[model samples]
Target: MGSTRIAVVVASTGRPEELGRWKEHILRQTLQPSRFVFAVVKPSDLPSSDAMLPCAEVVYCNPGLPVQRNAALELLLGATHIIAFFDDDYVPSAYCLEGIVDFFQRHSAVVAVNGSLLADGINTAGIPYEEAIALVDANDRNGKPEAKVICSLDGLYGCNMVYRSAAIGAERFDENLPLYAWQEDIDFAARVGRRGGLALTTAFAGVHQGVKAARLAGVRLGYSQIANPVYLMRKGTLSFKAGIRLIARNLVMNHVRAFKPEPWIDRRGRCKGNWIGILDLVIGRDHPKNILSIRQ
Candidate 1:
């Protein structure tokens, strides 16, 4: 057994098939996790067959990214030395988790790490399994960096984030922002950084397939896009300049893309939502929690 007790927490909703695919990739890791915890919004969301995946635990909770991720924390109180989070749509290389373990073992001062995203795009629907595997392999080959460890990153990417359990005592993902909960990872990473260093490493890497379906409506996501950063800024979790930059980028992209949206995205809807958020801000109605009023 490895000296470190590694655990994986995957928060998923309405993506059983994708969860199965992700599980297949995770099981391929060379240094296996002592616990593989899958948190779903509802128990019924997972098909009976998927319950057979070689996981140490499966938990059901209220439907929301932050809430689901936070729920997994309860299950890990005394279970793991390291905890890693992965979006259900990603496919990590066999060495991803193994490399993470090695990095934490070497860099004792580092509390959190994010892996390189090998292949991520706006659309990846209807991709065949063979094609997906080829894509991951191609990305893995091309994304290999000269330096194994890159330090002092501002935050961890939600797609592939790992943390030393000791560094996150009593800290849980913030659940106030609803749905996509934009910038939740940044908020969490910033808190973790307060304790120790944050790093992005080529040593641990994965492919974010960017699944097209089963996502929040574009308007809801757009509102969160605009409101979440501002909320974080107010809470001092995010900088004002950084928050504006993020908002401006999304505002432009959503508007421009709305004119000619990609096949898989709701660009116009997001653009509309962005407008609603801006208007709310103008009228002193800016609230990240307002996302709950939106119908899925």
Candidate 2:
């Protein structure tokens, strides 16, 4: 805890505007990250110019969340005490980083901590950036209690999770789980959790803007919905019960909602993809990256 160097790693593509909006909040954290790494598919994924350019490092990688994440992990391993992953559109309270630092310092056995969310926009039409920031700012002003609510969890949520670098050692994300890398967090956490403890806590918190831009095609996401969990379950990173549950939930939502889909979601495309996934499941042809080959 004495020399805890925290570094932030963000993976994104086609959302340079999101990075610009997220940058100010990251810099204003009460305990700033020792290093700021933005892993992207190309130079364009970042703003053309930024006042914080000198303080941040940009690493380009193949287009995928897991690929970019692993790139940052490789770069930050020896230099960082903790590595934090925040989605590009997320808005964290000013105390977010400081709260996490305190949480880990107090709970030495915890391998990773998934922060509580003030509000998550992923379930609906994406939250506007300004609205997300306002929600975060209001929560910050209300005061954050020191009293902690912690519980053991089988996995960490990807949007805003922090991990102890030492605990991570040589581990890496599954690069094959391309693009948004659905369920990648659960797979990563489920394995690392066995080495120590995994926790869900209120000490750290943020808002998930869930900007819908740069998302993978609905059919692709739909395909991963079924294939990835089956793959992970076989890989032993996901339990059979959990895998089945994920597969059922996604399939049902896609089908039921296809009739009256949200303007923000591609429920119809997802439904078709779900059928393709089921056929692949029976024929032994599905893979998470299979989505990459499927045409929109």
Candidate 3:
């Protein structure tokens, strides 16, 4: 696949530094994209050309991960054969784009592919750029050899996934899913999976650089933890049992971890939010949109 055949879409909000780091990584890719589209919630926050790595078309969209991504998709219409979405905070390997194009070329039946994370943990935002690269290098040294492909994943990781344009026609990310759109990628990828196949690959890779400081307020994320899964279950994207498992795991972890909070996580705040969500659910008010109405 030629560089002209792929387009890269990045959805970002208020995290200029991380986005810059990601842009540098993308600009250094072995296989460059035909176009780079950066979507930000506030148009004013879009980086000027002088600060950008290359000529990227910056777009303004409402503040939601899925909504921003869909905005990028609109601009990319008919522009490329493949569309790849990367979180603004992730630092993908140099061969990431090359691996994506290669896999799609080799597997005509596959609609999407998720790149593996070099690190076991997600919070790499505070690490220096040089150290972050070193960490990925360290992981690669001790990590298992890269696999050509892994079969049968339910969906793509939102952080690093690529899709064939033809397979994704008319399908857009669920806008109803609010900020961060927790699990929106899973819902969208499951739709793609139903049309064809979905797989993950070690050959394609990235580091999440979670960017805890840029994350949603602890309470918002906490509420989403419980409310979002239930919402997905209600929408048929997640089974009831699966939703229960997700909620239970989060509730338990938040409760337990609050006692021994990790520096990278706001465990107590999340736990408080979890209980608030549960209380809301019990009172027949578990909808996610209700979050905006609540006073923090």
Candidate 4:
């Protein structure tokens, strides 16, 4: 295949050490990307020159994941053809780019592809090398050839997904939800799929070092897990019927997993924030801001 410019966008905040490890993994990739960009909440929060990855262009954000992602997209717009996004704590395989590039070339209709993510805790040194190697190899074995649009009502995961620059155009992560994480991927992917874009799952994968939520501001990491999907549903990106199904499934699973101590946590929070978000929509709260964030 020709040298397609692929941009890897890493939206990070408060994980300098994990970011350093991810940088090393990117440097060691078998099929190097045409370009790499690191989108951070604060460039000053990043490490010194010695710790930073060579050739990585860093862009600062306003302490929000969607904001950081949008900034990264804006910066990489003209320079890259494929935009691959990863979390700060995930380390990709050496062949990650190669596999994604191959899939894009082979599937002309595919607009996005997500690599499998294996959850590994923070102590990488504690994990045996063989185990890590096996996790990477597992992705290679799971590779499948298929062409279809992913339209699950719940939407896609942002951790290890790649997107087509042209298909997305000026569309970007919605900033209305405002939390630093969650549901943004699902919102974007649902829009893309509705607009005739295809999202695929590939064998090339990465290992996510499950960085503890307590490390970064105790920002209620799982709150978005409950909020974002509901916000999307109320906004009409996800149908009400489908939204109900999705919520039901999530509630059941959370119960099985015993999500939080109180069963009424989600119910209560949704009653508060979702109603306000809906009213905000009716009264035109921050609509201009939302529109501006997506402007090309």
Candidate 4 regions with alpha-carbon error over 4 angstroms: 118-134, 137-154, 214-227, 249-296
Candidate 3 on 34-77: residue-level lDDT in tens? 88888998855566556686668888878888889999999986
Which regions of candidate 1 fall more than 4 Å away from where they truly are? 47-51, 122-129, 137-147
lDDT of candidate 4 at residue 142, scale 0 to 100: 55
Candidate 2 local lDDT, 1-296, one digit each (tens): 34788998888899888887666887678888899999999878898685444578989888889999999998999998888999988889888888888888888889898888888999989888788888888888877635264689998889998999998977899988988899999999987887899998888788998789889889988989989999999999998998999899999988888999999999988888888888999999988888888898
Clashing pairs in 1: none
- Return the TM-score for candidate 3, rounded to 2 decimals: 0.91
lDDT of each: 0.81, 0.87, 0.79, 0.64
lDDT of 1 by residue, 1-296 (tens): 38789889888888877777755776667778888888998765564675447664788888888899888988885779899998877778777777888888788888999887766753545455566678667755654333367657888889889998989998888888776777899999998889999998876777777776678888888888888998999988899999999999989887887878877778888887888888999999899888788665
Model 4: per-residue lDDT, tens digit, 1-296?
45788888887777676677666777767678777878887666576778888888888878777888899888888778889988776767777887777777776776777765565554333334356656766654655323233342235667777887877887888877564555578778777655444554543667765555413221132334344555777777767786667656654544454434343233334333333434555665523133223211
Q: Cα miss at 226, model 4 (Å)?
A: 5.1
Best by TM-score: 2
For model 2, how big is the CA root-mean-square deviation?
1.4
Clashes of 2: 0
What candidate 2 gets wrong by more than 4 Å, as runs, is 51-53
